[model samples]
Target chain A: MGIIVLKGYMIFTIVLMIVYAVRHLLFAYNRAFGKQKLYYNDIYSSRMPKISVLVPMHNEEQVLHYVLDSLLQCDYDRDRLEIIPINDNSTDRTRELLDEYHAKYEFIRPLHRDCPDRGKPAGLNDAMAVATGDIIIVFDADYRPATDMLKQLAIAFADPSVGAVMGRVIPYNANRNMLTRLINLERSGGYQVDQQARYNMGLIPQYGGTVGGFRKDLLLKMGGFNPAVLAEDTELTFRLFTNGWKVIYANSAECYEETPETWEVRGRQIRRWSRGHNNVMFRYFLRVLVTKHMNWKEKLDGILLLLVYAVPFLLAVGQLDAIALFFLHEMDILSGWWVLLFIGAYCSFGNFAPFYEIGSALTMDGIKNEVYLLPLIMYNFYFYMWTISLGFLDAIADLITGRQVVWAKTKRFTK
Target chain B: MASDHKRQIYFARTYRHLKANRAECALFLLLFILPCLVLLLLFYDELTWVMTNGAVWMIQQAGGPRAEISAGTFLPRLGPAYYAVLPTTQPDYSLILGNLAVCLGTVWVLSTGPRKGRPVAVYLSIMLLIHTMACAFFLLGKDLMPYTLEDFSDLYIKQQIGIWITFLVLIGLVMGVLGRGAILRRMLTVVSIMLYSFVLGFVRYVLFLWILYRFSVLYMPLMFFALGPFFDFLYFVAIYAISTNGVIRIYNTKKKGDWVWA
Candidate 1:
């Protein structure tokens, strides 16, 4: 029975890996060749919606000025635009810096949070309560949006159905080191291909936490951002989709952000992401299945997207299972057509962003020479597997023990 | 203004996209897929012979143990092929206990030390986990040990052939469908990658044999599982990247404005 279970699991893992491989391949092919579904870029209105740009800062003194300065330079109408930099219990010079910006610009508002509940979601909840805009856009303290980014992101809300809008993120310090370069490739593949293809296919396009915006009234109606949820972005995405609202991807609405330059920082960042994403996954997996708002395709893609963070953990366990089966001399698992399936799965098992997907994305991005760093993502496979698996365990523990989800900030290397 | 110019160039190159050309894709399929099938059919025996001879020569130079090359058939329909045969060493009681103790000690050190979350620590722990499993299997379930050294060599050669075939097909698919370049450059990229794979496979086979001959068969699972074709694909991707870069460079220089804007 034990042997049967291992073999069955091995087969199941292979099938799952193959399904992801095919899904990515289709995404790559579509992004490369298929007619792209356009964003609402050309839909200009004389009367634009009132917008509040929220910059969430927590001890982000090193990188706070870049985002604030960029936001000041944006071309949005001064009467309609407001910048709120949420100072969430920041100990560094962040509060002072925001105050300086607020004194200089009438539109720049600084919200200071001295209370114990400190995180992006809680800060956002507080900021949203006082924000005087119909649409609320969010950017991390490290992000430097382009002068027209606000207009591009806000234009999507002109359509009543678009609950949220996500823009493409380009790494500003991609050439810093090998880690940053690899991350740049991942971001390229993720946004340029994955998100764009999902939008093109009329599937679910996730509203990433930053470089994105949503209807403030809609979120407020849904009881504001959940302070308990670490992945407020993913949770809000599912909430909006399952409630019949759309999240649109604007590929042209590009912004520059810093990526982690060191392996340790990247690992912690990935682990935190995995934990938060998995928590959201556990909460919404069943809801996506039963939600009447989503069609069959939307539900399928939604479930797959939710399970994205969990794949590395599953693949890691699958590796251990393969070893156990090998020790048990259960080589019969590789018989006949199983050999092909096993080999295919082995090739596809690492990095959720497959080589072809990234390669095609880089090609489309007109990025030359950076594609050479594509192979190094193999090392990242092990890194992500172990770290994400730990995060998965953390999430499972969170569910069982009802542990408080602390927002672990990613170490900024901008200075 | 300079940044704006740079942005314009970047967007010009990226925003202008390419439509799928069925003819180019078909040609790519034929270019790679046909050659791979042809090579497998005509030169499978010869390729295996070269790999077998290379392994034997390397093992002899190492002067660790006596190595012999023997002919064997994996699937009867595929015909017979030459493979390296090495004497298999079963782990003695002392060896098993010693390795197990070492694995446990390392695991303890890693878990307790400051290197707990480090990648190197994680990598070492994974390697130790496999070695520990092998030690346990040798200690508790020695009778269930399925593969000997010869069987492993046979499987390695068979999988190496499969790897080569798949490499060719995948490279073809990626470069043909996703890649933008002149046909000659694309073909050259495929050839370069195929050559790299051939050399890599030979060297890795010899290295695995040398390790297995010097050490016991206890490390067979580690070599097969950890340091196998997966690592080979890493360099394969690297070569593909380099080639793709070359294609992009040429396109940017010559046909910069030819992109079909989305």
Candidate 2:
């Protein structure tokens, strides 16, 4: 019975890996060869919606000025734009810096939060209460948006059905080190291929926490951002999709953000992401299944995306199961052609982003030499597996104990 | 901020199909398919013989007296193939207990260490887990061990063949489908990967045999699973990435206007 169970699990893991491999391959192929479903890039209106750009800062004194100055330089109409840098219990010079900016430009509003109720979601909730804009855009304190970023993100709201818009993130410090270079490859593959392909297929395109915006009224109507939820962005995505709204991906709405320059920082960042994403997964997995707003394809892709954080944990367990089978010497669970299938699936499973997907993305992005860093991403497979699995366990513990999730920010490396 | 304008080209450009490159596509197909056919039909015997002889020679040099090359038929239809046969070392009771204690001690230390959540800790924990399992198997299920040294060698040779064949086909498919380069560049990429795999596989085969001959069969599972074809894919990806980078550089330099805009 034990052998049977192990063999069955091994087969199941292989199948899941194959599904993801095929999904990635299809996305890559579509991005490379298929006709792209265009974003609302050309849609211009004389009367654009009032916009509030929220920059959430917590002890982000090191890099607060970059985002504020960038926001000041944006070409959005001054009468229609408001820059609110939410100072969420920051200790350093962040509050003072924001005050300086606010004094210089009345449009730059600094909301200082010294209360115990902190974090991005809570800060966003408080900021949204006072923001007069119809559409609210969010960026991390480390991000530097282009002059037209506000216009690019806000244009998607012109479509009544688009509840949220996610922009592409390009790493500014990609040339820093090996870790940063690998992360740049991951970001490129993720946005250039994965998000765009999903949008092209009319499937679910995720609204990442930063470099994105949503309708303030719609979020307020659904009860402002849940302070208890760590991943307010993913939660908002599912809430909008399940409520007959859409989240569009604007590939052209590109923004520059800093990626973690070290493995330890990257590990913590991914772990927190996994924890928050898994929490959202647990909250919305069932809702996604029965939601009438989404079609069959949307539901399938939604479930797969929700389960993305959980896969590394599952694969870790699958590795242990393979070891058990090896020890038991019952390795011939599937013979003949199944062996070949198993090998193919295992190859795909070894790397989270398969070679072809990353290759296709680099080819399309016109990136010249960074393609050489693709192999270094293999080390990230194990790194992410362990960190993500630990985060999965943390999420499980959170559910069992009903503990409050504390949001941990990724440490800024920009000096 | 000036780089922002240059960055816009990444998304602003359009893509059209490489319709004029049909001849290159045909060449890619031939490059991918022909090598596998030739390796299987013409060079199978010579390849297996080289692997077997190399392993046997390495084992003898590493102080294993009884190592020899042998032949076996994995599939009756494929005829006999060469494999290395080495005497298997059995662990004594004291050695098993000592190793088991050491594994447990290290795992306990790792679990309680300050760097508990770090990657090094995780890797060590995993390695200790495998070693512990091996110690337990030798201690508790010595007679139940399924594979002999000869059996392992045969399986290794068979799997190595499978890996080479798969690498050829997979690299071809990846280059053919996603690779953007002249046909010669793409073919060179495939050849580079194949050559690297052969060298890596040969070195690993000899190293595994040397370790097995010195150590007991307890480490067989580790060698087979942990240090097996899984690590081979690492260098395979590295070579492929280097080759792809070269292709991208050439395209950007010489064929800048050939970009298919979407």
Tens-place lDDT per residue, model 1, B1-262, is 6655655535443345675688887877786668666777567778889889878877888895667888765445665667899988777788889989999999889766567766667767887888888888889987678888887787787777767766776677777777776777888888888888889889999988887767778788878777877677777888888887886676566866656667
Candidate 1 lDDT over A1-415, as tens digits, reads 9998988887888788878877887898889878888888788788889999999889999999899889989999999999999999988998898898888898999999999888999999999999999999999989999998999999998888999999999999988978788888889889899999999999999999999999999999999998888889999999999999999999989999999877778888888888999999999999999999999999999999999999888878888887777666665354222433454454554465887788878778778888888777776777788999998999999999998988878788877
Give the range of the ten consecutive residues with the poorest summed lDDT in model 1 chain B.
B7-16
Per-candidate TM equals 0.92, 0.90
**lDDT at position A125, candidate 1:** 92
| Model 1 steric clash pairs | none
lDDT (10s digit) by residue, model 2, range B1-262: 6755665444254233222354665676775557565656466567889878877776777777756778765444554567888887777888889988988998888778465655556666777789888888889889888877777787777777767777777777677766676677777888888888888888988888777777777778777766777677777888888887776676567876776555
Highest-scoring model, TM-score: 1
Give, for candidate 2 chain A, the lowest lDDT window spanning 10 residues.
A332-341
For every candidate, the chain B TM-score is 0.85, 0.84
The 10-residue segment with the lowest total lDDT in model 1 chain A: A332-341
